[model samples]
Target chain A: MIDVIHPSLLLFLGAAIVPLLRGRAQQAWMLLLPAAIIAVVFSLPHGSSGAMNLFGMDLLILRIDALSMVFTSVFAIITFVGALYALHVKDTTQHVAALTYAGSALGVVLAGDLITLYVFWELMVFTSVWLIWCRRNPVSMAAGFRYLIVHALGGVILLAGIILHVMDTGSVAFTAIDPDSAGFYLILIGFMINAAVPPLHAWLTDAYPESTITGAIFLASLTTKTAVYTLIRGFPGTELLVVLGVIMALYGVVYAVLANDIRRLLAYHIISQVGYMVAGVGMGTIMALNGSASHAFTHILYKAVLFMGAGAVIHMTGKAKLTELGGIYRYMPITFLLYMVGGLSISAFPLFSGFVSKTMVVEAAALDGRAWVWLLLSLASAGTFLHTGLKLPWFTFFGQDSGLRPKEAPLNMLLAMGIAAFLCIFIGVFPGWLYAIMPAPVEYNAYSTGHVLWELQLLLFTGLGFFFLLKHVGGEAKISVDTDWLYRWLLPKFALGVQRVVDRVWDAVLGGLMRRLTWLVSSLTHHHGPQGILARTWPTGSMVLWVAVMLAASLLLYYL
Target chain B: MDLGRLLEYLVENARVLRWFAYVVMAGLVVADILIPSAYDRFPWESIGGFGAFYGFISCVLIIVISKALGYLLLYRGEDYYDD
Candidate 1:
């Protein structure tokens, strides 16, 4: 049965074959694979179905519960959208990497055991880094290297935790475990790194913007959200996540505000949006968990739409920095309108997808009686509107006319974006379509009078503040130093200084050894020369006389 | 209606739109007070126009504080890493 085959295996197998098919065959396969996977994903019934015994343990390979289903559905959808967007891209490596990356994420979401999850989790790191590296630029190559190092560290941490967790608990089921154990916390740290929690987060901001245009769409959608899914499955209600999540929510926004590059701005915003999901998971209530899951769902859509828009601009203009791009709407009005849909949706404006999903998390915080979290999250929302909603579009599409008159985005790009833009609005207007598929039953209404008024006043006044400080909010032609600066700049310089000192000491040690060898050679030469006792006629005869004398003495002794 | 022309017209008449926004803001503040809230877990909820003030203040602070920190500690030239 199609249902018997794992959707991820389908994708991996499809990726393996992508290079074989060429031209239109490859394109058809690229588009059809995700659609077929979607069919396979939906055909399977929700529960732990694909179970098999491997060695001593039972590996539950496919668990199609509501939570996994939510993420898996989106993974398939985004892969399709991403493939469509990259239809014009001739790079076979990127297509394969992206498909496999999506497949690995689906594998992560569906894995019913921790080991299964860990396997897919590590696969995600290797496959997704190629999406960045395939850009073939030095900057991307370097960024991809950093990205691999960070995620590999994360993978090691997760594996250590999984080993300890399985040994200690005697179970590998992917369920919420007690956070008191060292193993769980190690796992959490690993998850947090992939989730792009601050300090550990700079890799995301560093590598994502450096990805190929279509690659960023894939990069943006999968890794962190998959981590969020795993968190929901494994660590729902961990209290520390509340604080880290809030800090991440705000930290991302601050960096985003300082970002000059258009894609980097969006990348930082990914951290910010994911922060909301993390906070929801931290709240740990049914409503909050559902909120986090649903928010992940919606965030994937709107964020993808947002990336698609930014990508369209970059694709057209060959410029990614905001300082270098302006008044592009004149040339690409369709792209402009589509991008604004994403912008407004992300800001949680009423009737947008973000409004429905993001508010639920805040509402969950309020319902859980976390007043401070509620306030901070509210502030983050306003900030979200300030930068992504109002600032990004205003500066990029409509701000100072930098007079870049690139042609409109290619039709394939627009078609993919158009699909994403449509979904963003579709879910916005009819959120029940999304809510029905949530991990938990939906009880919250987004359009209550108070909620509407509050969000409206919040977003509207945020708009007011934007216009009030229009000049101040514009992007500068400067790059923002994130936590990656510690490794990217500070660590390398520190290493170089250490190397210089090491080199000097090494040279001195070698010189000292050489001096000693020279002295020993000179002493030996002096002692063995004609002027020395050893250099007497007997010795000067090249030790032959001495050998003859020793032989004679031995023979005399033998005769005696 | 031609959407581009409409958008252009909107952009050109920015001053009037700014005034209109201010008027809307004032009206919303009054409505915020008059319209009873459904959830009042926080004290700020009871305060009329709290959302407006909080939103405006937070947005301003996000921009101001972020820019201050950015200028002070975060930003470098585009070639900062390239070297």
Candidate 2:
């Protein structure tokens, strides 16, 4: 008898039934599934399950441990929250896609083998692409295809690595990989692509803003966090990741400076935020790893809240660009207030969730005697406050009026944001609640006098800089090109160039050959035609005479 | 009180809020000087208001550099991709 049901299984089952039901029943079922999954996840014991010997390889389907439990628990909660925020959406396809996309993400976190992980990884791509496509616009269509292609390429690289890894080790278990192993870099690249490490990160900022308003929340929450989970599980203590992570941290903040779209700005911050988790995974100390895990946990909640707030504004006003918005605080004060909680939490302000988790990694860097890493990470944190905390909210809700006063978000959306905001503050206030669930013992105190004073000084000063430069920081009616420009613009143009050359070559070489062949065919047909000299009415008589002559010659030759 | 009215009230008293921010910032600097941290890992971290200076400078530099980069390489018309 099965004592533990995989949470993903429940979500997948719910997704199938979603399209069959309608109206309030479907909505209730959607909410019920995530709630039940949360219960199931909590009930799950710390061990492997669904073990089987497939083709002489042991396949562990469900591996529950301290690390995975932390990720899955948060994932389940966000699924429920995301579902609630999406309650106003009437599109059943969006509902089904959201559920399955979430289920696949849970599947990835719960997977014990690389094979199982890869299957769910690809499932996540296919199912989640619908969220972008569900917007049903040309831009989304193009963005969705690009998202699909990029992930497909990443999936192929991962599959190649997994095959080689299994060949070298004769095991498919997902664990810490030896760097010198044949598949190490291949697998790392694949994970890094999903992690949205720059150069490999364009797919995220490209497609997310184009996704449907409800879909953007799930899009923001799941994909990269799962990638962080894999990086933590697989490539802990990678020194290269340390460098890459820091670059990612600053890279996102730098790019966010140019983001005009509200969702796109938040999307870049996801990269900035995930950079902290990646850096922690690279540090690889118990404190650092714990920090990474807890950060991912807090991050999922806070980021969901942030996305929900942004989505709410877009939902009501149908405007997503920061340049096109302002003075809506009077119209939507609750959203402004709730969004502030997320902003403060992300900025690591005192008594916020980020303070508890982000500092652990930065502290780990300090303890390790890496001053540059610590300082750079701190700078990135300042940048975080500058963008997500100050610039976004200032221009979006509180800046000079754009003369648009849209109504507040719907009831369900506000409630979802409210729940997430409560968690952010609750975790901020009593970090013990979050600490108890960490993968390791929590020894650090976020409320210590020194840490709080330093954080306040850093964030508040950044706020001052924002006000001073208020004239310059407002969103412009322009976009900043990222790595996507390579594929979206350069690659297509290059392909067209290649196609023109090929066409000319075909015309010169194959076309000439075709002309010759055509002439030969016509010549042969002309000679062999019924009206030709060779095919006249006398052909039968000539044939008989030639046959008789040949017979006589053969008889004379035989006699001789 | 309604949240809108509260916000409106704060906005109307923007001067007071601005002064409040400046005063808090000043207080934080003094606190940093008075209360030395046991957890200061770097030499500069022990300096009063190092964080404040760095935060301000970093914010300014980030804005200047990002704007420069944007103007030089990144910024394009909104329809840059459509073509």
Best by lDDT: 2
lDDT of 2 by residue, A282-357 (tens): 9898888888898888888888888988888888888888889998999999999999999999999988899899
Query: Residue B44 of candidate 2: its Cα lDDT?
Result: 83
Model 1, native contacts kept:
0.74
Tell me the DockQ of each model, to 2 decimals. Answer: 0.74, 0.79
- Steric overlap count per candidate: 0, 0
Question: Taking the tens digit of each residue's C-alpha lDDT, what string does model 1 give over A404-438?
Answer: 98887899988998998899889989999999999
Candidate lDDT values, in order: 0.90, 0.91
Error of 1 at A432 (Å): 1.3
> What TM-score does chain B of candidate 1 reach?
0.83
Q: Is the docking of candidate 2 incorrect, acceptable, medium or high quality?
A: medium
